[model samples]
Target: MERWPALELASTIRHDGDGGVTDDLATVQGTTRWIRAQSDLPAGHAPAGDIAADEELRTEIVALRRAVRALFARAVSPAPPSPADARRLMPADQALAHLNAVAAREPVAPQMDWPLDGAPVTRLLSAEDDPKVRFLAALARAAVEFLSGPQRTRLRACTAPRCVRYFVQSHGRQEWCKPSCGNRARAARHYRRQRTAADGGPAPGGPS
Candidate 1:
């Protein structure tokens, strides 16, 4: 199974300074759809049927998102806590509990198979139709692999101001998630220097 999509699921919400920018997977059905779109589903197997529109499922999805976010915090520096008035979306303990439960679910197993060249290979297989459980298990397992893999060092949180997303650094000089974010960061820096100059002071981060 592809691990990147499961890792991407952890980014459903983007943490900002005071608030967070949430993606579209805010509901049970939406989460299910996202999983289907991201996961390697079998041929002719439908994903929408497994998803249900219910409060319980919604709660699970929200909890899962929070758990993933909390896990991500372990790998990257997280934003500061929201103010008292703003709801603390994901408590550390709660997220941990949910993640543990998800991890407890059975993982997708590898099937022994051989190609036409008789080369040995193992194929990951999953027959579960329960999108919630399946995705939870898949994501939890993927998280373990990701955190332990060499690629973990490449995982980075986007440093662009107000951008709350994580990305795998593809190049040595890559910093932001995308070129647009890099551009924004550069623009923000230039603006800050100009503002400092206008204030009759040395530009921030510049020569004294």
Candidate 2:
């Protein structure tokens, strides 16, 4: 499955097997590592190998992530949002405004590139010298593009026990983010059924 940067940003806050949430961007070092791992970022937008994240950069990226996750929650309307940050998600309108503002921070122009033996491709050319601005702008733009695209309709929050992630449903029966989440959810359901039967209640799927 193709990983969307916006979705990845929202997934930074997820379940840590011990029933707690782990934040991938919790500190400067972690933020730097996360930025370096985003190989999918467009050319000229990703920072150089030696780039290190500062407090300011980390805060900015975390704020952008907040906005992105807020919009992701809206995208999966009626369905519950990720339990990690659902209680503190920015308002939908504010999130939209923030995303738009951040995306406009770095102005870009289309630059077509064609190698002698390859097909032509167009990429955004940014004149912004600040890597921070370019990086944040790229993330915001990705969120904007993803929210406005057809894939938004497939967005869903993982329903597995202790899971706190959003995912794009790849098929009709995909209820969880991955096979592991599916397994967890099924196990939880079975446990619930056993408990209910032990309590002298009707078995699941049987008449009450």
| CA lDDT, candidate 1, residue 116 | 85
**Model 2 / residue 191 / CA error / Å:** 0.7
- lDDT tens per residue, model 1, 22-132: 565776666666655653433222333445546675566566766666656655545332121125546666766777787667555678787788987666667665665
Number of backbone-clashing residue pairs for each candidate, in the order shown: 0, 0
Write one digit per residue (lDDT tens) for candidate 2, span 42-79: 55454545557899989998999999999888888888
TM-score of model 2 vs. true structure: 0.94
lDDT of each: 0.63, 0.88
Candidate 1 local lDDT, residue 184: 81
What TM-score do all the candidates reach, one by one? 0.73, 0.94
Clashing pairs in 2: none
